[model samples]
Target: MLWAGTAKADYRDSIAVLRIGLVETHVAATDPIKLEAIEHAFSGALGIPVEIIKLGSYAALIDAHASGRVGYAIHSARSFAATEAACGCVRAFRSPVAADGSTGFRSVLVARDSVTLPVAELKVGYSSEASISGWQIPHQAMRAGSLDLPKLVRAGSVGSVIELYQAGEIDGFFGWLPDVPGDAGSDPERLFGGWNRAAIETADPVRIIWSSQRIPYGPHAANRSLPDDLVEALGAFLDQMAVSAPGLLDIFEPVYGGGYVTPDPEEYHNIRGLVEALSDRKSAARIP
Candidate 1:
């Protein structure tokens, strides 16, 4: 039942984080309100207290869930892989449907100034293990543009990419789209540029040079010890959150596309395969 979040405690704080055995915390990914909604919906569906956990970021979510410290999770495709690989009590349950009504979201190559550029020429930056967006999608998009990647770098997160761009360390980068706005303005259009409801699109300020085909988002998962009925009910509750189609669209609009769909683990095999291929390529390249 222990969820993940950072430990910054004051004696006066009611919800003390120190109580949880937190390894670390990262930047908050999804908003707190949205998280509350998700937790409530899951609780209503499962008819259980359903201790909701907050993860700092994708990596933290992956690590905690993978390590079994946190039993359940809804995380990015890449994070899911890391968790699945973590042992102890790690596995995947479901991937959210894309806002476009697909199994997953698309990867867009973006320039820092928000300008469009040749997908291939831009030195795409990504997490060391961005299975879908960083590697497969960008690589595929680059090939489509008939441009070979000039240089590929491994960055820790989007913030790192922004820093690099500001420092002129890299021209442009490609990575996974987020589920919320870019955190730029009050309107929430600045972050993912309000592309949360669908795949990343080309804007006047930023050009979407290349976009990979849609892929499944993340899974609604729990520890291996979780009873089968609980998992099924949790998924059902998430599915039930849509009392009205319009009500459901609220979540969909952010990530882009139609609305939430059922989880599909098999669909991720393509992404998994791509990661394996990338490892092989990297190994071959390293061989003198």
Candidate 2:
């Protein structure tokens, strides 16, 4: 946990020793299992333990990385945005696959199967405004599809939206991801069905329609506080792990690709557009 160095280092070695931030998992470098597997993959190559650091929420984790307490963050979409924009201490790593891998998350519009109606005929209830899938992606889809959601679906908290959906309070529910909102993965807690199920699962009978294109995946950003040379060295280390410890990589699933790539915002062009347009909409609504 403190520092893992089984042997002395040589200048010729491509790996640079460093620790992984907590919240990854509790496991020893000699043996990293399941989701915690990433901890030691970095450890073995870097020739160090990569202390595991844990945080409370996405916001807390971003704060830690931005402050330079951690070298990098494998994080969700918006929090990553807030971190880069605020501290400039972090940069994203290019990923091979999106979080959910490739196709990414999709937006789902739900309605009671008991009713046969056009999207315009039903009042739609959407998840939390703070969420990308709940509010952001749906909003974008509405605009792009030339549908006026504000006039049809009511925007509210996620729980409220679900309640409305079941109550017949709203004719339909607008949810991102039939999977997750933009650049996010499934929350087994928030999502239900078989272990293999995806997106908007529920105890109630609700029919859904595709509302938007697939959402993008996100990256774990490196700390800008590190020296450029060290960053480059770390990247090399990750590249090696892709092949050397692919089994470990497999456990992380959808999170890590073959190896680290340059984290670019352009990979998430649609997400960026959604954020900008949403910001503008909220700002406009605030105007007197």
Best by lDDT: 2
The local distance difference test score of each candidate is 0.52, 0.58
Q: Candidates' TM-scores?
A: 0.50, 0.58
Give the alpha carbon lDDT tens digit for every residue of 17-115 in model 2: 454454433223224454355665666555555665666667677778878777766666666666665675677664445333343455566666676
Which digits, one per residue and each the tens of the lDDT, describe model 1 over residues 222-277?
67766666556545655654554445436423443444565555656555545555
* Candidate 2, residue 180: how far the Cα is off, in Å: 14
lDDT of 1 at 57: 65
**Candidate 1: segments with Cα more than 4 A from true spot:** 1-40, 88-91, 105-136, 139-214, 244-257, 273-288
Q: Pick the candidate with the highest TM-score.
A: 2
